[model samples]
Every structure is written in C-alpha cells, then in structure tokens.
Target: MSDEDSRPVHIRRRGLDPADELLAAGPLTRVATGSGADAGSQWMATTHAVVRQVMGDHRRFSTRRRWDRRDEVGGEGVFRPRELVGNLMDYDPPEHTRLRQKLTPGFTLRKMRRLQPRIEQIVAERLDAMARAGSPADLVEFVADEVPGAVLCELVGVPRDDRAMFMQLCHGHLDASRSQRRRAAAGEAFSRYLLAMIARERKDPGEGLIGAVVAEYGDEATDEELRGFCVQVMLAGDDNISGMIGLGVLALLRHPEQIAAFRGDERTAQRAVDELIRYLTVTYAPTPRIAMEDVTIGDQVIRKGESVLCSLPAANRDPALVPDPDRLDVTREPVPHVAFGHGVHHCLGAALARLELCTVYTALWQRFPTLRLAEPAQENRFRLTTPAYGLTSLPVAW
Candidate 1:
C-alpha cells in the first residue's frame, strides 16, 4: 500500500490506551491511535514519518522554541515559572552554540570521570537509606527520585538543606494536575530561591558548576540568566535520570534472564543500559516544533507555523530501524537511538545520564541479587499522562 493509504491502517491498529501500554506495545504507531488533544490530529498520526523525515533532513525540522513553548503553556506566561528556568535549551544557532560552548566543557569525559566516585558514594548512601527503610519501599521515592536531585544540587551549588525543596519545585512544575495558583507560587518561590543562591555564589563561589559558570561569565551573566541555567539543568538532569533508573530497574525485574546476564557479567551492564533506553524510550514524545518555513516531510506538506510532535517512542521502535524491536535484548549491539533526542536540541546531559543509569543498574542488581518487584508487574503505575513517561512508584524487595 502507498504511504498515504497505510496511514489510516496504522492509526486504526494502534488505538488509544493508557500511556504505559502505548509504550509497552512498541513505538511508531499512528498518532490518531491515541486519545488526548492530538487524537485524530493529522500531525500526530504521522509522528514516525515526521521523525524519520526530520532526522533525515535536519535543516527543515528545528527544536528551537519547542520546550520554551511547553514552558509558556505550563507556566502560563514568560514572567513567572518560565522565567525561572533558562532559555539555553530552547534557542537556535549562534545563541545555542554560544551557551553550549560555555557549558559543554564541564560535561567532558574528564569531568564525568571525576564525578564517578562521588556518584557511587551517593548511590550507596541512597541504597543504604532504602535498606534502613525496610523492604517493599518505593524505588522511585528513595533511590531513583532522590539521587539525581541531590547530585544536581551538589553540581549546581545549591545548599544541601535546600535540595529537597528544589526537587519539590521541579515536580510541581512538571505535574500537569498542579493548579495554576500552586505553579505560580512554586515558580515565584523557586525563582527567589535560585536568585538568592546565585547571588551568594557570586560572593563566596564554590567548586561546583554554578561557581564555575559565575567565575567564567562574571558580571556578564545576569542574575536571571544564571538562575535560569541552574534551574534548567537541574530539572532536565534530575527528571530524566531519575526516570531511567526507576524504569531500568523495572525492566530488569520483568526480564529475569536479562538481569541475570547483566549481573553475572560486568561487561553486559553498558549494553543493557543502552537496550533499556531504546526499549523504554522513557521521554516518550519530543516537544512540538513549529514549522518555520513550508516543509515537505515525506509525502505530506507541512505548512509554515504548523506544530509537529515527534514521538521518540515510535521512532525508536520503527521496525525499519530496529529488527524485532519489541524483544528486549541486552546483548543488542550499539545502535543509534534518539532517547536523548536528535538535532541541535539533543540533551546536553546525555553522558551524565548514561553514567547515572549504568551506576544504578550495576549497583542495584549487584547489591540485591534476588531483587524483584514487590507488586504484580501489571499493577505498577506508569506516568502516561505527562510529557515524560515513567513510574510513580516502583515497589521492590530482595
């Protein structure tokens, strides 16, 4: 069948279901197959086609302003919550290049290597806390949720006492069900907190990234800009890493043989992490991009100013790209996946995220050889309604 003729068939086959099942089923479905505002939206059903088109031709598809637009919608305006997080991730060309140049140095292999020992210490501390809390503890509530935020706080120079509050603020903004009033309050409070932290860093300066950014930029970086970068990095780093840890653990539990292979051989952890990222495609969908110019994606004509959402989950699972994509195989060879995204707006913290995932999976499985889900695998809650997909709670026992 022609591509156009197959679109409807694809849509009909993938019908709307919970977000978890949508993911568990595999990627590259017809967008109209799902419920939500995008349901039946022509642009939605063509997600897989559009992603292939975009990845194949980067010039026509841009990520600039995608996340910014989401922030505007989520924050309600540029003046409040949106202002608290920086625009580094949402800019194009020269500006993005400039910011990335300044920031990329810190995420280098040398820097990540230095952070490794500390990450292990932090992981052990968290696992110890979980052990103290006893069995059947929520994996998300303890290790997956807390470790990344704490690590981010240390990296950005947030006071140790304030890490919990910072995490809470991050969640409040990301949670769609949060009332406008609550978001506003959280935004304002976070802005004030960040501004204060930036001001203090300017005066005393520390060994962390915030101090380094301040030292390099000095007076050139305004309070708003510094605070924005901190908030953006913190949120981006914490949320994705946390979700991956929780989801990776769940994946291992579901596939016992894979888990055994991974734990029995240290070499398998890296490949397993890659496969989990590919299979889970945890971020779910890419931010909607507005066509800056008239663009032809595949056979479809996309008009200027129209919105296009790329479902990473679908793209990662495209049968054309990954053979037998539904089957989880830790032994799968290195294959390029868009879990961190594609194009200029790809995730800046990709290396750090991978490090954390490797650490979590390696440590968790090794520490608790008999680890298994405390609840029925099917009963576990997955975050299907959000822009990012993950579990709310991952109860486990050893």
Candidate 2:
C-alpha cells in the first residue's frame, strides 16, 4: 500500500471533548494553529494518519524548531520564565550531549536503586495520608500529584516547606491561557528564590543533584541558567509523573483483573507501567518543531521553518506499530513507545519516572488490595487546558 494509504485509522473515542478539540486542530488534521480548542476544526478521524506519516519520516519532520519553540512558548523567552533547570531536553546536539553526559551519572541504575527506598517511603507516606483521609480520597491530590512533586523537590535540594510554592508556579506555568502572565510572575519569584538558593549552595553546597550541577557547571551556567535548570527538572519531571500515576491508577482500577494480575506477580507492575504510558500518552501534544530545510513527508512537502507537531498520544496509538493498538494489555510484549519521546529529545527522567510509577503501583496494590475508584470514573475531572494531560482529581476508596 502507499505510505498515505497505510496510515492508521484515527478513532474518535469518548472522554473529554476539549481534548478531542485540541487533537483535531493539531497537525494530525491539517487544521489552523493556536492554543485553545475553539480556534480549530471539528474532531476528525485522520489524526492517526497524520501521526503515522510524521513518525515514519523524522528527517522531513524535524523536531529542531519544536525544541526552540518550547523556549519561546512560556519557557525562558519574552514574557515567560527563563530556563533555569537545565539538564538536556531543550538543547541541540553537542550542547545536549554535554549536558546529558554530566546528568547521566546521577540517574544511573545504581542511583535509582538507592533512591528506591526514599521513593517507597514517599509513596507510603502519601498512601498513609490518603488512608487517614478515609474513603473517597482524591488520588490526584494525595498520591499522583503529591508524590512526584515532593520527590522532585528532594532531588533538586528544595526544602520540603517550599514545595507548595514550587507546585503553584509549575501549575500556573503549564496553563496555556495563563502561561504568559503566570510565567512572568512565577518566573520572577522563582528566579529570586533560586538565586538565593544557589548562593547558599555556593557557600555550602548540599549533596543533591542541584548541588552537583552547580559544582560542575557553575562557571558555564549563569544564575538564570541554574534557575532554568531547576524549573526544567521540576516541570518536566513532575508533570509526567503526576499524569502517569493518575492514569496508571485509573487503568488498574478500570481493569480489576489486571490489578489482580499485578498483585499476583511483581513483574506485572513494570509491564503495567509501560501499558499505562502507552495507553494514556500523557504528553498529549508532540513538542512542536520547525523544519530546518525543505523536506518531503509522504505526499506533502513542508517548507523550511514551517512548524510541525508530533502528537505522542496519536503516535502511541497508531495501529501500524502496535497490535490491538487500542486495547490496554499490560501483558503485551515490550514494544517501543514514544511516551517519553524518541530520538535525541528523549526524556532524561525516564528512569526516575519508571521508578516512581513502579513504586506507587506496587505499594498501593499491596497495601490496599481492595482499592478501587471511589467515584464513577466518568465523574473524575480530567485536565482540560494544559500542555500536559492529567486528571484534576482521582477519588479512590478501598
């Protein structure tokens, strides 16, 4: 079959209509571009086709411009906050490679192994807090949101008392409508806070990852760069974890049999995590990229500097790469998924994300074998207007 003809069939499943609107205006449908849902076309069945075409030809569909636009859109440019939390995601080659090299040592398997206990403790504490709150607790607030935010703060050397402010800035920064304004406000506040923290670390460096980054790249990274790095780590790391944890929990709760399987076999947790990542595809929109040069993708030729978005949710669900693509089969043999992105811009915190996910699923199931969604799944509030997809609240009961 021709490449275009071979594209996956995009299905319009039911859930949040707002998300459907966002997906419709996305590159998948060849619709108009802007932030909100109303500025675009109605939901179309061609989204899957668009995703297949983009992923199949990366050369023509460059992520270079997308990475640059990340900074332009509410991240370290003009009205937005500066990139203070720098590890690797935003940089291109050479610079990206250098940053990744320095950061890799801290996220190795051995390091994750060491961090597991703390992760477990954090999970347990959240679960305990949930239990104390009794039945019908908001899982998103208690477990999904709290655990990741706390862990990221700990990793970055931010004290526990300051985590609430960090989360506020993060939430505001991700809101598309408020991004410009909130980013300006939060960026300024965070900059001052980060500068003070960096000065303190300079005087007496702590033993956290932030301290390490400052020690090694202090001269190279300006005060703004350091703050940007902190913001990047916090934003990138916490956003995915929160969404994945919520989705993972919802998936397991939806399929009690799968939860039983997970409980029966510890190995099931890892596979389940993969399935959740693939199924949920939290980073719904592909980070937009601009074409550096003229390129042909399938039947279309995108001119240089034109913007293209690679929708991860649509790509992960593409029937071409995955068998029974729509089905949530935790037992499916490992197939590569782009939930953490692909190629050079792959997520640096993949290891930590996996750790957090695995720990939460395992511990929550083991602790509350009777755990189930306290409210009807339909009643749960999914995120409507943010760059990342997630639930607003996940009420759970045992």
On the 0 to 100 scale, the lDDT of residue 316 in model 1 is: 68
Find the 10 residues in a row with the least total lDDT in model 1: 9-18
Q: Tens digits of per-residue lDDT for model 2 on 1-398? A: 63322222232223422234344454434544444664542222224555545544544544433334544422344222245236344455666567666656556677677777888899999999999998878889889888988888777788778878877776666656774877778767766787788888777777566677667666565565566677777777787788788877887788777776567565767877788788777775545655556766555666666666666776666666688777888888767877777766677778788778988988898888888888887787766554466788888888
* Candidate with best TM-score: 1
Q: Tens digits of per-residue lDDT for model 1 on 185-240? A: 88678778888888888898776776777777777667876777777787677777
lDDT on C-alpha atoms for all candidate structures: 0.69, 0.67
* Deviation in Å, model 2, residue 138 alpha carbon: 1.5
Q: Which candidate is the best by lDDT?
A: 1
| lDDT agreement of model 1 with the native | 0.69
For candidate 2, the 10 contiguous residues with the lowest summed lDDT are: 4-13
Off by over 4 Å in 1: 1-42, 45-59, 66-85, 264-267
TM-score of 2: 0.81
